[model samples]
Target: MPDLGETYACVPSTERGRGILISGDPKSDTILYTNGRSVLMLDLNNPLNVSVYGEHAYPATVARYSPNGEWIASADASGTVRIWGARNDHVLKKEFKVLSGRIDDLQWSPDGMRIVASGDGKGKSFVRAFMWDSGTNVGEFDGHSRRVLSCAFKPTRPFRIVTCGEDFLVNFYEGPPFKFKLSHRDHSNFVNCVRFSPDGSKFISVSSDKKGIVYDGKTGEKIGELSSDDGHKGSIYAVSWSPDSKQVLTVSADKSAKVWEIENSNGKLKKTLTCPGSGGLDDMLVGCLWQNDHLVTVSLGGTISIFSASDLDKAPLQLSGHMKNVTSLVVLKSNPRFILSSSYDGLIVKWIQGIGYGGKLQRKENSQIKCLAAVEEEIVTSGFDNKIWRVSLHGDQCGDANSVDVGSQPKDLSLAILSPELALVTTDSGIVMLHGTKVVSTINVGFAVTASAIAPDGSEAIIGGQDGKLHVYSVQGDSLVEELVLEKHQGAISVIRYSPDFSMFATGDVNREAIVWDRVSREVKLKNMLYHTARINCLAWSPSSTMVATGSLDTCVIIYEIDKPASSRITIKGAHLGGVYGLAFTDDSTVVSSGEDACIRVWRLTPQ
Candidate 1:
């Protein structure tokens, strides 16, 4: 599938993309963040077992845990609110479309019965309050002329709600059917972050104009500013309250996260946490959340850092990964120790077992990669930029990449590993032959061949056409000679895979059907394996040549053992939170997969 529209638009790091959103699960040492289009649930205690929640159709902007700790409310750029069980398998219990534009922030009431979703809603309400279960509008958020950037509910009884918006005003509301109380306009510019104290006696709001003001949580009366002197030199993006409500934490573009003692009318700086990074104000802090004494901070690069009282100067632990949807995945046959993955942002990450998150593939423009073929020495890639890149593989460095013009952009590539010499490229118009980065020849099969595969010995070339016909051709010299046509599929063929042994092959179609063919006998249908309920996206062969793994749009990964074809099929339904788009086997015991969920997972098939 192509990159989704308008979801991943690029803007300045300070104004666009995902902000450093971190929500702490009151139940434990967990922190939630938006990993591209999905949410990542990270446990500070374990750190390695990162569980992901990936059901959103659009980019998720903010997520918050209900005070009761039993539910989570998340909002997307498309103004959709989803309330699902936090500990009960995350099944959606309620969904609401409260606004017309993007939702920038979400918060739940202390009773966990009410939720307030705030966003641009350019043409409609800037914010709204509703019943959590019934989606009934409980109150209106008035007095904001622009987008409401953030909202919070007072934690204690006399129920109160506070919202900060781009209008440089903070609106306070007073219950089940909340009413607008008043507006606190101390800030001179766009207000970004606002939060209520744990005790509900006080609240704080920060603005891009460097103002941090606290107010009486109950009456919406302005108490005093955080620092009476000037304000933050840079924009204050987020803030949090300590468990005891005595200290307030804030992160800002000034490249620091600090703690302030909450005095009666004013605040004093207690400690400053150091964030280590370089490049374009690399340490520019964006978002923060307090997990007990532990402070979690998010950087502009999507790196999460943990800081505590004992070691307030440093972040002892951090986790990093792709910040966009993974578009393609491939493993080098010559060196299977590392796996390479490409995302919608044109970022290519190299993942190793011991080390994590290797840097992106070095490209001048970093266009969206269309197809990738990897060998031990180099990785060949083609993308929408209409250029082919030959990258020298050296662990995660990606050494040196040479970009060459490929007249027409290629859609897919087939690496003939069995022969280890030929690489076939498929474009909309025809197919091209590449002999180690150099285009040697072209074959005009003419009918829009969408998928292609090379025979094990590199002697036969198979192409799947839009007409649902599999065209078999002999690879002689440079051009192809059509030998036969197999038509058993009723829809366009999506993927075709040649078995390692070259005895048989498999082809899957858009109609959710997969078929096994005999190469030696040239039979169109050797076996009909029909179990998936959605379109088969990609297929891979096991190292043993007996098992074929098929990834589909239905989110299932099925392994077909040719011995029994139908009965020996093992299905891993919902193998991925979203549809699987790519599959590859690193060895006989391990198969790696990545899909729309923006996650790469490994399924082990070794002995128990």
Candidate 2:
């Protein structure tokens, strides 16, 4: 409701394990990648024009652009394959349950009418081919006893399919109801990737044996092999061919991606791509793709590095963000450029709007962060680890950080900047008052805490509890003494936020009900203001203090105007791929939010 569209997008795809899909061709500058539950299409020429098709029921594992470029064939973890129109209309052409397990890889034929998919399916650990528009079986895949890891289609006709699997074998197939043509026992370890060159004259495969083999695309004869001695220090994971079918890009577990110039130039070491101190073994470069002028590689740390032919050794654009469920985000009024967000994976990152990723702030808790608040030079966060952490923005300039253990798991945090020494922590045990890493006092609410907010004056504190009740307490310097209880909600309270001007406060409950109450008297101002149909997850107030925005499980964000209460509501349904979990207001009213979709979107409100 606040905005018609998103201004800028924070691109961060979840690196679930090793299956990172980057599919595209040289002619078309756009490359498709899986981000959260949606398939992202980003134009190499115009990165800002990222299109997200997010109707997948399960997390997407593989996405392939049809040869015709008019259709998209995608497979998910649920073993379901969906062929949909590529025009963003979400027109479903066909759906097929190709396997009973995760689909590891899928590719469309050169003709673009049929697709072959394979993975760790039930006992049917074989590749299967079917027509794109109608779920008609086109062929069968066999010879691999273990899970099929990757598959590729020969681009220039004669219709050939190559598949590699955990059985350490590569099988070539041919025909309409495809039959096995030849089985090559080339790798000593599990084969990880199988890819065909653009010319269809040869193909390549890499395996966990730390080797990569090139083969004749038509005859299935091994042509060459990239040895472990000089190829890669660690096992190879993926292989992608250049558009001209002259160069091959291979990513490995050794934290490097290499390009081998073949054909006209003979076998030569073209270049080496490495991020010296990016990380340890955990930051293995797992996926690589070549798109015309640039090459994109993914790191195990979920970092995307784009390299150009002009500068092969140095990656030009390295995009970094978050990769798990974003739990909390805070944007400070003073440092408008810095945006801080914490995730369920115990990750905390500081983002600069104009730049990419700024830096990282460490957290003591090892669990999901519930709430975060910024104070002058310090940032305080509470988490499911039952602890309150004091994080310094810049440790050298700010004070050192400290952690206070709460008896019960903390769920939310509320800080009154006016009383810098006081921190209000909501836990399943009760509402605790902490004075600089020490518990001043606690008031047991007898219910689990969901959300909390402190008055601008720091004199009163309101906590939303699991029992759908509001527990109001009078703040006495460092402790909170229970004052009263408001029990109008029928469901657990999800969010509570005080207006910027302290004139009113809003509480959103799980029942999709959001109520605005008078801050001074704690009396309901807007009762039964219901626009959402699902559980409310987050709520934020506009900088001007006249409007309130709420995000819910319904995948919608609704903004309510205070002055024009009755009819001043704007609704942006399906605002996020999944339900919205965290929302923060930017300086210029750009509502930044993160959700199950694993993407952080900045919606630019169309001025009303």
Identify the leading candidate in terms of lDDT.
2
Q: List pairs with backbone clashes in candidate 1.
A: none
Global CA lDDT of candidate 2, please? 0.77
Q: What's the count of clashing pairs in each model shown?
A: 0, 5
Model 1 lDDT tens row, 1-608: 11111111111122342244568786777777675567666676665556666678887777888877777788888899887777767988888897899888888888888888888887679999998889999887778889898999898989999998889999999866888889978889889889998889999998887678999988889988787453467788889988889888888888777888889858888887766665455467788888786787877766566788556765446555555556677777656757788766677777664444444556555677877777677777788887777778665566777776667878778877765457888888889887767778877887988899888678988999889999999999887899999988988999988987788899998888888888889774336777888889988888678778888999888777676746567777676656888788777667777777667777767432
Q: Return the lDDT, model 1, position 136.
A: 91
Residues 275-331 of candidate 2 have per-residue lDDT tens digits of 544366547887878877788887776676788865675646766566666767778
Q: Cα deviation of 109 in candidate 2 (Å)?
A: 1.3
lDDT (0-100) at residue 428 of candidate 1?
86
Which of the numbered candidates is closest to the native, going by highest TM-score? 2
